[model samples]
Target: MQELAEVRLTAWVHGHVQGVGFRWWTRSRALELGLTGYAANKPDGRVEVVAQGPRAACEKLLELLQSGNTPGRVDNVVAEFSEPGDALSGFVER
Candidate 1:
């Protein structure tokens, strides 16, 4: 079987995302997709989500982040793609 390429996705979620359990919701979605990373609250009222895993899984997570079905209203999502780094275990909410 051919292994899928791993990648990293850093998404900065904007709008009413800070105090609405967005990080926990993101962590749940990431874990369900078998991704590893963290969702942290930024001081600028944005939630930063970092997920690393298979390219497909990462994309799925990104989709979920902007699905408009999360804990809070996501006005916009700015995402960056890059190579995965370090060994990430479980998804986390920071």
Candidate 2:
């Protein structure tokens, strides 16, 4: 079978995302998808999610981020796609 291409997704989630378990929820989703990266709280009240894995898995994570089923209210999600650079292990919430 052909292997799926590895990719990285960096998403900035805005709107009532912090202080509401958003990072923890993101970590859970990332782990479920077998992805490796981190979900961090930004100083601007947004949550930044970085996930690296198969392209399809990364896309799924991005879709879930914008599905409005997360912990907090997500007004918008801005995502960027790129080639994976750093080797990551388990997902983390920061």
Candidate 1: stretches off by over 4 Å: 1-3
Q: For residue 14, what is the lDDT in candidate 2?
A: 96
List where candidate 2 sits over 4 angstroms from the true fold. Answer: 1-3
Best-matching candidate per TM-score: 2
Candidate 1 lDDT (Cα, whole model)? 0.91
Global lDDT of model 2: 0.92
What is the per-residue lDDT of model 1 for residues 1-94, given as tens digits with 9 covering 90 to 100? 2237899999999999988888998998899999999999989999999999999999989899889999879999999989999988899888
* TM-score, one value per model: 0.94, 0.95
Backbone clashes in candidate 1 total 0
